[model samples]
Target: MQTCALAEELAADNDFILYAASLHPFARADDQELSEKERYEMIMQELQIIGRRFISQGLHVHVGMPDGETAIKVCNLIQAFLPIFLSLSCSSPFYEGKDTGLLSYRTKLFEVLPLAGLFEYMENWNHFVDQIEDLRKYGIIGGIRDLWWDTRPNPQFGTVEIRVCDLPVKFTSILALVALIQSTAAWLVEDVEGSSALSPYLLKANKWQAARHGLEGRFVDPTAILGDHPMQFRLAAMILKSRVSPYASKLGCDSYLEHLDSIISGGTGADHMCRIYQNTGDFHQVVRAIQKEFWQ
Candidate 1:
C-alpha cells in the first residue's frame, strides 16, 4: 500500500505500523514472521542479517500547518513533550534479544539527520522564510528542505512532519501519536507567538531523560530549571489534557492511554524486551516473537 494510505488508515484509529521505503532494499514486502527456531534454521535475520525482518517500519505523521510561525510554535511546544510521547510510544528495545539500552533504537537511527532536536526559536513567520532564504543565500544548507527537527515544516503539504516514533506492531498507536500531534497543532494555532520560553539546556535535558529512562523517569518540565517543578508538571498535563484529549478521544485512543499505563506499570519498550530476552534465554526467539506479533 501507498505510505499515504497507510498513514491515513492509521490516523483513523490512532495506530501505526512499520513503513519501509523503496529506498531500503532490506525492507520486507509482506514477508511473514518466522518462529524463533525456524528463523534460526533458515538463517533468516532482520535488517542486519541474511534476511530482513519487519522491524524497519517508521511512524511519520504529517500535519498541514499554514506557515512557519505556527510550525515554530508547535515544534517548540512539542519538543518538550517529545520525550514523554516517545516514552509512551516506544516499542522496539531489542533487535535480537540483546538489551539495546535504547527504548526506540529505530528512532535513534532516524534522528541522525542534520536537523534533529529542538530548533532555534524563529521569532516571526517572516523570519522563517528569511532564514531559509539566507541559508540558501549563504549556502549554509539547502532551502526549506529538511531542517529535520523532531518536527519540521513541510511546505509542500503545508504541514509539519513529526519524525521521531518507532513503527508500532499495530497501526493504532501511530494514529494516536498523530492525533496527539494534530490536537497539539490546533492548540498552538491559537497562540501565534508562544506562551513562555524555556532555556535550551532544559529542553535538551528532557530529551536525555526520554532517551535514557523512557517512561520510568519523573519527566522534568522542559520550561523549568532542573529539579521538581510541580507547576511545570501541572501545566504540561493541562496542555496535553486540553489540547490532545479532544482529538485523541475523537480518534478512539482511550486505549492509547491504557497502553501508556501498561508501559509505565511494566516497563518501557526497552525494559520489557530486555526482560523477555533474559527470561527466555534466547535472543533469536525474542526477535521471532516480536516479528510474529508485529508482522501479519
Candidate 2:
C-alpha cells in the first residue's frame, strides 16, 4: 500500500490515475479524447496494424532457480496451474461501462498478442534456446525477452516468471500468489514424476475456463485420482489445503496463503466489481470501490 501510494504521488505530475488492470468504462476506443499512440510505443511496424485498442495489466511472479535448465523444467511444470492463479486473481470484469460476462476480460484481450498466452511445451533448455534462436534468425524477435509466454524462463535472472495473472485488486492477493508460485516451484524441483505434466491442450482449456468463470467453472482434472473432474474452487482448495499452506508455513507466509480462502469462498476482484455494478448500475462506483479497497 505504501509503495502504491508513493508511485501515485510520484506520477501525480504526469496525470496518472494509478488504476489497476484494464481501463474503466468511461474510456472507450471510440472516444476522441483517448489517444492510443500516446500511451504505448509500437515495438514493431507489423504491430501497428493491430492498433492498441485493448489495455490490460497483469501480476508477474518470478520464482528463482539454481540454473537455466532448472528454470525451464520448473516453467513447464508450472503451466498447468497458471489458470488457477488467473482465476484467483481475476479483476477485470467490466469493459467500457458494461459487464463483459468474463471474469478476466483482460486475459482474453492480452492473448491477442502474437506471442502471448500459454507457451508451446518445450523439451528442455536446449530446445528453448534453439526455438528462440530460430525466431531471432527470422527477424521475428530480437532476443529471448521478446517471447512473451504465460510462463517463461528468465535466463538472466535464473527465475521462472509466471505471467498469467491479472493484477488483483487486493494487495494481499499478490503476496499469496507470489508465495504460491515460489512454493510450487520449490516443490516441482524435487524430482516429481512425468504424470504431473499435462498436455498443452488441457492446460489451454483450463485457462479459458478460468478467464470465463474465475473460480466458479469446472476444470478437467487430467491427473484426478478420483472419479470426475472438480470445480475450480475445489482444485484451488485442494492445492491451498494440501500443498500451499504447508509450503507457506515453511516459508513463514502462512497468513498470506490464508487470504486465498476468502477469495475462493466469496469472490475475486472481478466478482466484487460485478456486485458493485449490479447494485449501483454505475461503472464509476465500481472504479471507486476498487480504489477504496486499494487504500484499505
Candidate 3:
C-alpha cells in the first residue's frame, strides 16, 4: 500500500496519467479510450503481440527449490492448488462497465495468450529441459521465459514460480495468499507423497470454474478422485483447517492464514466490487471501491 501511494505520488509529480487496472473495466469492448497502442509500442518487438493484449496485473509467488529436478517436482505438486488460489484472489468480475458475471476474468483473459495454462508434467529436469528446448527448436518460443505456464521452474533462481493469481486488490489479501502459497509449497517439498496427482483435464476444469464463480464455484474433487465436485468453500475449509494450519504455524503466518477464512466468508475482492456495483448501480463507484481497497 505504501508502494502504491508512492507510485501515485510520483505519477502526480511527473504529470503523467496513470490508470491502475487489472484491466480497464471501462474500456473492455473498446480500445479507443485506452492506451493499448502506447503500451504495445513500449515493449519488445517480438513480445508486442502479447503486450498489446496484456493490460492486466498478476501476483507471482516464487518458492525456492534446490535444483531444476526439485523445481519440476514442486511445480507438478502445486498445480492442483492453483484454482484455489485463483478463487481466493478473484478481483476482475467487472469488465467494460458491466458485470462480466465471472470472477477473475483476468484468468481466462491471460490464458488466451500462448502457453499460458498448466505446464505439461515432466518426469525430471532432463524431460523439462527437453520440452522447453523443443519449443525453442521449433521457433515456437524464443526462450524459457516465453513459456508462460501457470507455474514454471525458474532455474536461475532455483525456485518454483506460481503465476496463476490475479493481482489482489487488498494488501491483506496479497499477504494472506502469499503466505498460503509459500506454506503449501514448502509442505509439498517436504512431503511430496501427500500431493494430489490430478490430471491436466481436471486441473483445467477447476481453473475454469474458479474463473467463472470465484469462491462460489466448486472445485473438482481430488480427494475423492471420482465424485460430484464439492463447493470450493467446503474444500477450502477442509484443507486450511486440516492440512495448512500446521504449515501456517511452522511459517509463523497463522494470523494471515486465518484472515483467509474471513475472506471466504465475506467475499473475494471481485466479490466486493460486484456488491458495490449492485447497491450503487454505478461502475465508477465500483472503481472507487477498488482503489480504496488497493490502498487500504
Stretches of candidate 1 exceeding 4 Å from the true structure: 1-57, 95-98, 106-112, 191-193, 223-243, 249-267
> What value of lDDT does candidate 2 attain over all alpha carbons?
0.73
Give the CA lDDT, 0 to 100, for residue 262 in model 2.
72
Q: Tens-digit lDDT track for model 2 on 1-296?
A: 68887887876778765666544655674443323573245453456534345655689888778887787777777776778788888888877666788988888877777898877767778989999989999998877667778999887877788998898887777777677777777767774443445677778888889889988876765445222456665466556446655666777877877777777777888888888888998887877778767644
Best prediction by lDDT: 3
Q: Rate the local accuracy (lDDT) of all candidates.
A: 0.56, 0.73, 0.74
Q: In model 2, which runs have C-alpha deviations exceeding 4 angstroms?
A: 11-16, 30-40, 49-51, 194-197, 225-228
Better of 2 and 3 by lDDT: 3
lDDT of 1: 0.56
Task: Please give the lDDT score at residue 124 for candidate 2.
Answer: 78
TM-score of each: 0.67, 0.88, 0.86
- RMSD of every candidate to native, in Å, equals 9.2, 2.9, 3.5
Rank candidates by TM-score, best first: 2, 3, 1
Give the poorly placed runs of model 3, Cα more than 4 Å off.
Answer: 12-21, 28-51, 194-197, 223-229
Model 3, 1-296: lDDT tens digits are 67767887897799743444455566644364344574344443655555455567788898888777678778877787788888888878766676778888888778877788987777888988888889889988777777779999988788889999887777777888888888887777776553435677878888898889888787875544224556664366446445766887898987877767767788788778778878989877776777766645
